[model samples]
Target: MDTSEFNHGHGGEPINWERAAGDNAFVFMKATQGTRYKDPWFAEDFAAASRTSLLRAPYHFFDPQSPYDAGAQARHFARTARAAGYTGQKPGELPPVLDIESALVNHRAACPPHTDARQVAALLRHIEAEFGVRPVVYTNHSFVTLCLAGDARILKGYQQWLPAYQSEPPRLPGTGRDWAFWQYTDRARVPGIPGPVDRSVYHGSLQELRSMAGIRGNPPER
Candidate 1:
């Protein structure tokens, strides 16, 4: 599930992490955005997920228009995630993520002029240095088509989390690279989550997923 402070259970109840674990393999939580604005729900939600069998991770919402540079944002994200207990070396903990999309910010319109591949690449590199593992990239077709021109050599090594809602798996807009994780739906109804939630699938086997989290051996029992 891809969740931020905005998502809530029925009647604004907190999500039942135990219930979520029963239905899902992993949980991606929003940690930080730009150079500040840490998700209010992130620390609590990430800690709650730790007790469950679910693999948990954090993502940063990249803002190319921010006054701070990519390095500052990366540092802020890494610090916030570290404070939230995401070490990336722990069991069931995946690497940090960069959420770069053509999305609105603080009631503003979508950003078309500020998107830069250099910034994205620099941010990813800084994050990888912090965690000692390759970070993940969460993006969509529109952003790629509008900003990245469908091909970014800098993105080749990082895992791609493509959100394309359709029956068929999505091809990475211009790169023709296979998606590592696919967010197939935003209206998925799981037992633990009251409102609609985004759900995604990992392309490889359970073992491969564990490996990505720096874990070895069999999948953790739920």
Candidate 2:
């Protein structure tokens, strides 16, 4: 239930792909969310981390724009993440994610801004076609309810990286779509950072996750 308190990660930490093969799942040290994206090291770190057994994905924080051009942002992400030389199996090893924050929509929607899911879907499809990999969605519970509440059709297919602060995130209820991972808490004191960091867990077995990453062969159950 200690959701807001994620994990720790700042400097360099030697990632052991095999060791990470444990239930550690993955951690998305959102670089773009802050000014960190401009630093080349962020991209390098992302690449190195993706090589590990844990599946690593990078995301962009979309701040107030029409859904029409959103796919372009995702495309830029695909290009940048790759050009930065983040190690991976091309499109499959790592997924590009869209982080829709409060200002993502022009101005705002309403008390809870409603997003055009159909447009969002087209953007996602464009990303997949352009990059050969499907993108994941990251959102807080509040924004999710506001924007994606009624758009179950597309939500069900994509991976949901939900941030449920101070409480355990809601799991897939009667909804068949299962959450691939849960960002349970932040400030986990994970080795590498100056301060604390954010930590999360994959909803399924490591092998299943690997499969999602297109590892080709099946991995053992962790």
Candidate 3:
């Protein structure tokens, strides 16, 4: 599951890490947005999640139309995430996530500004270089089809975290590509969280999840 400050206001209480990690194998939380803001609860929440032994990852909200350079934004995300204690070296630590949903760009407006897919890709590459681990791409179908049309190729090797709220599985953008994580619902009532929490499923076994996070040894038997 993943959360940000926006979700906290809607009956979202401080997360009970042990209770939340009971049914979840991985947890993702927003660390930074654009090039300016850091989530106030990130440091505390991250430490809590780590203490629970849930495989954890921090995501950055991408703002393609922001005035800052893409490289700058990537640096901001890496620096903030590292400062928040994401070493990308622990057994249960997953790579950083890049949130590219259209909601970040006001896509519902009458006329959304064009987002350059190349620039987005550049940011991802820069982050990968900075962190020494390939980041996961979190995006919805529409953004991939519309804003990133003809340019999705730049994201060729990255794992995808797709959100499709239907009962059916999501259809990913690239040919032969599959989802590494699937955000199945945003209104899920998880035990440790007070209100609705976005829930996702890792697309592999516990061992595979550990491997994806670059953990070296045999994972403790679940």
TM-score of each: 0.90, 0.69, 0.89
Q: State the displacement of the C-alpha of residue 77, model 3, in Å, after optimal TM-score superposition.
A: 0.8
Per-residue C-alpha lDDT of model 3 across residues 69-120, encoded as one tens digit per residue: 6788888888888887887777678999998866534435221253567668
Candidate 2 per-residue C-alpha lDDT over 119-193 given as tens digits, one digit per residue, 9 for 90 to 100: 556666766776566677776545544656633456567787776557767743323565666776665554334
Q: What are the lDDT figures for the candidates, one per model?
A: 0.82, 0.55, 0.79
Predicted structure 3, TM vs. truth: 0.89
**Ranking, TM-score, top scorer first:** 1, 3, 2
Question: Candidate 2: where is the Cα deviation over 4 Å?
Answer: 1-25, 29-40, 50-54, 86-92, 103-115, 149-151, 171-175, 216-222
Worst 10 residues of 1 by lDDT: 107-116
List where candidate 1 sits over 4 angstroms from the true fold. 9-12, 66-68, 104-110, 173-176, 220-222
The numbered model that scores best in TM-score is: 1
Clashes of each: 0, 20, 0
Report how far off residue 221 is in candidate 2 (Å): 10
